[model samples]
Target: MRAALFQMTSGVDPAVNAAAIVDAIGRAKAGGADMLFTPEMAGCLDRDRTRAAATLRSEADDPVLAAVRDAAAKAGLWVHIGSLPLKDERADGRWANRSFLIDDRGAIRARYDKIHLFDVDLASDESWRESSVYGPGEQVVAADTPWGRMGFSICYDMRFPDLYRALTNAGATILLAPAAFTVPTGQAHWHVLLRARAIEAGCFMIATAQVGLHEDGRTTYGHSLVVDPWGAVLLDMGDVGGLAFADLDMGQVADVRGRVPAITNRRDIPAQVTLA
Candidate 1:
């Protein structure tokens, strides 16, 4: 299966971002891509809490999702709108960082909210308290598609290897980590972490990311990538707004697993603690 990953520098307006998404969909279709994946916060990006709150729309009312869904239908392509910052109905004031998997017919096949919030304190006063604004997701997700059984995750989830193991155990052959990662962390650990996940799970790992500076003054380190089961980087779309393409060799999953079989070799051990 052929896929296209969108590296975006989204702004505060959902409408404008939606238009750009539609255009990218068209380009992906033209490029003979069967599936298209986009970066996190493709719907909108704003640093100011007040402005971001005002701009967010409910999933039912989001124009960005509606536009991309329609575009996918028209082109007969599978689409993953990596993550959208939406108004969460269940939570009173907090929002939802949600990801979607759309079929060729424009139907939503699966939905995964970002379970891990990016609450971290970086150097030089660069910090974020994502959990304060967005409620965390409770469920893990894996979806069946024409290509393979796809596992879904967002930005901060990359830091957690256990989640990827769970998904792989649940029959995931391809893992997606769509992100809006900060420059410092992305530069330091992005490639290493993603490749490690792929190597461990024996699954292809794909990460579409947000890049460049936004209107909100936040900058993302964008290097959208596709890693093979052998921990090889197939494609890397650098810090720019564009598309990264790659073809999946599904047989590699079983081939690599047959050799290593790490996922199948399991042992449970109790932790031993000695009083000091």
Candidate 2:
């Protein structure tokens, strides 16, 4: 299956980002791609919680999502809208970092809200409290498509191995880790972590990322990647913001799993506490 990954530098305006997404979808369709993947916060990236809260809209009212779904239906493209910041009704005023999988007919096939909220202090000046504004999702979501079974995850979730394992156990053949990683962490751990996930899960890994400086005064590490089940990099879209393609071979999953049965070679050990 041919997949198109869109690396974007989204700004504070949802309309502008929507335009970019629409154009990328057109390009992907024209190139005969079966699917397109985008990055986290694809709707809008804001500098502060206040501005983000004021700018974001609910899923039902988001123009960006509506436009993308319409384009997907018209172009007969299966689109994975990486993640969108939307107002969450369950948490009163808190928002949701939601990912969507739209079918070729413009219907939403699956929705995965980001479970891991990024709340870290890289430095005094470069700290984020994502959990402060966005309520975390409690479920892991995977869905079936014509290509194969796909596992869904957003930025910080890439750091968690258990989630990937669970998805693999649930029959995921391909994993998507769409992100808007900070420059410091992305430079330090992005490639290593993603490659590790692919090797461990024995599944194709696709990561479409946000790049360059944004209106939010944040610089993202942009290196959208596609890795085979054997942990080989198929395509690495360097620090540019655009579309990159890779043809996925589902047969590679069985080939790698047969050689290294790591997923099934596990022994459960009871937890114990010992005095240090």
Candidate 3:
């Protein structure tokens, strides 16, 4: 399976972000990517609560999603429309960080709302309270693709290893982690964390990211990456806006598991208590 990781620098305007994504999808198709995955926040990253709320659209009303569905059909490629902000009127008008999987026929096969909400205070004085303006999702989603079962996850979800573990155990050969990692954490832990996840799960990890400062003055650590099942870095781009394509040989999953069968060697024994 040939996959393309489309790294992007999405601005605050939904229209501009949509145009950028359409072009990237075309390029990925031209480069022979059977499937394409974009980074989190594919359309607009406005931090302002009022602005974000005002711009939110339902799945049926989202124009960006419409374009992506059409583009996937035109190129005859499976596409993962990274996390989009969907308007939710229940929480005094909030948004849901949602993702969509488009089949080759340009029809949405599955949708996943981001289950983990990022409500942390970063060291860069860059604090984000995603739950304050966005409602958290309860469902964990996986899509069946031509290649294999592809698990869906957004930015902050990468830090949680159990999610990936569950995915791989549930017959997922590839896990997609589309993120908008901030500068501080991305610089320190991004690559190592990604490689570790791939090694532990024995799965191909595709991580596309936002590469630079956004229109909201939020700087994202943009090192998009692809890691093999054996904890090897296949591709890593530092602050570049483009697609990273790699041939995912599903056959390697067997070899990697033979080498280090970590996933299957778990013991449910009680943990040793620390001397408090």
Candidate 4:
């Protein structure tokens, strides 16, 4: 199976963002991709989370989604339309960071809400308390796909390795981390963390990311990648806004499992603390 990872740069406009997504899908289809994955905050990446609330759309009336679903049908590919804004119950009209898996026939197979809220403080006086803007997901998701059971996660969730292990433990072979990682922390920890997840899970790790600047003047780390079960990078489109392509063999999963066997090597153990 072949997968396309879209490294996109999204701002505030829905129409413009959707058009860019259409173009990325075209490129991926032309490259013979069987599956395509876009990044987190897929439609619009705004600086003001409060203003972003006004743009959130329901699956029922989103024209952008309709067009993308149609494109998925036309290309006969499973499209992971990473994360979008779904209106929430908050009085301020917050949104849930959600992802949908649109099948080859244009059916919405599954939806995964981002479980981890990105509430962090960086050195730029740039701090995000995602909980103030969005609600956390109720559960971790591992969805059924044609290629394999694909585990779904958004940006900040990558910081937690146990979640990936749980997903892989539940029969997931393809792990997708759609991120709009910040330039600073991403430069320091992004690749190292992603590669570590693949090596630990013995699975195919696909990451579609946001590149360049956003409406809020925030730049993202956009080295989107596709790593194999053996921890080999199948393709890496470093800091580019385009499709990162790779042909994935389902058999290699078992091959890597046979070699490393980390899954079976897992053992329950007690925790230790270093603080004194």
Candidate 5:
């Protein structure tokens, strides 16, 4: 399968970010890509909650989602919109960090609200409390694609291996991890974690990321990568934001699993263990 990855430096404006994704859709189709993947927070990345809240809309009303779906249909390309911050209807009034899988016909195939939220205090003294604003997701989502069953995840979710194991156990051959990572963490752990997940699961790992400085006065570590089941880095768009393509061999998933068979060999861990 031919995949297009868009590494973007999304700003505070939804319209501007939508336009960039739309353009990438057209370009991906023109380049003969079957699917396009984008970074997390593709719609808007604003640090200030008050400012971001004004731009956040429901999935039904989000202009960015609308534009991407329309463009995907027009381009006849499958799109994995990394994640959009959308207003949630729950009583707590928190928003959701949601990812979408749009079919070639512009239909909503599946939606995955980010299960793990980034709540960290970095060594650089930068801190984020995602749970304060966004509620955690309850379900794990995977959807059928032309390539294979693709599992979904957002930024901080990459650090958790159990999520990927659950996905592979459910028959997912390709995993999507779109992120807007902080520079310090990204530099230290990004590639290592992604590669480890792919290796352990024996599945393809696609991570498209946010790059460069943004309108919100923050910088992101942007090395968008596509790793094969064998833990090979197929494509890495290093530190720059634009459209990049990679050709995936779906058959490799089976080949790698046949050799390693990690997923098939997996056994349930006992609930309690004695101290060594």
Candidate 6:
């Protein structure tokens, strides 16, 4: 499968971000890409909640989502919109960090709200409290595609191995992790964690990321990567933001799994462990 990964520096305006994605859809199709993957917060990346709230909208009302669906349909291309921050319907009034899988016809095939939120205090003095604004998702999602069953995740979700194991157990051969990572953490853990997940699950790992400085006065480490089931880095778009492509051999998943057999040999751990 030919995949196009868009690494972008999203700003406060959803319209501007939408335009970038729309243009990328055409470019990706022209490049003979069957699917396009975008980074998390592709709609808008605003740090200030007060300012972002004014711009945030429900999924049905989001201009970015609307535009991308239209563009995807026009281009006849599948799209994995890494994640969008949308106003949730919950009584608590918290929002959702949602990922979407759009079919070639522009229909929403599946939606996955981020199960794990980034709540960390970084050594670089950067801190995040994602749960303070976004409610956690309860479901683990996987959807059918031309390539194979694809698992969904966003940003901080990469740190959790159980999630990937669950997806692999659900018959997913390709895992998607869209992220907006802080430079410090991205530098230290991004590649290793992504590779580990792919190796452990014996599945392909596609991680498209947000890169460079944004309008919100924050910098992101932008190494958008695609890892094979054998833990090989297929493509890595460095700090610069643009469109990059990778050719995936779906056969690799089965080949690697047969060689390692990690997933088949996995034994469930008990909830309680006795002290050694």
Judging by lDDT against the true structure, name the best candidate.
6
lDDT of 5 by residue, 208-276 (tens): 999999999999999999999999999999999999999999999999999988888889999999899
Clashing pairs in 2: none
lDDT of 3 by residue, 33-144 (tens): 8988888999878787677767768878888898888888988888888778888434566677888899988999988888788889877687788888778777778878
| Cα error of candidate 6 at position 81, Å | 0.3
Q: Kindly give the number of clashing pairs for every candidate.
A: 0, 0, 0, 0, 0, 0
TM-score, model 2 to reference:
0.96
State which candidate, 2 or 3, has the greater lDDT: 2
lDDT of 5 at 134: 93
TM-score to true structure, per model: 0.97, 0.96, 0.94, 0.93, 0.99, 0.99
Runs in model 5 lying further than 4 Å from the true structure = none
On lDDT, the stronger of 3 and 4 is: 4
Candidate 2 Cα deviation (angstroms), residue 79: 0.3
Candidate 6 worst ten-residue window by lDDT: 88-97
lDDT of 1 by residue, 22-132 (tens): 998999999999999999999898878898888888889988989999999999999999999988545466888899999998999999999999888889589899988
lDDT of 2: 0.93
Model 1: lDDT of residue 60: 94
TM-score of candidate 6 relative to the true fold: 0.99
Candidate 4 per-residue lDDT over residues 43-132, each given as its tens digit: 888867567667767767776688889888887778998888777433455577888899988899988888899999999787988887
Model 2: residues with Cα > 4 Å off, grouped in runs: 273-276
lDDT of each: 0.92, 0.93, 0.84, 0.85, 0.95, 0.96
Model 6 spans with C-alpha error above 4 angstroms: none
Prediction RMSDs, each to the true structure: 1.4, 1.4, 1.9, 2.2, 0.7, 0.7
For model 3, state the Cα shift of residue 219 in Å.
0.8
Worst 10 residues of 4 by lDDT: 86-95
Model 3 Cα shift for residue 272 (angstroms): 10
**Cα deviation in Å at residue 44, candidate 5?**
0.3
Cα lDDT of candidate 5 equals 0.95
Error of 4 at 119 (Å): 0.8
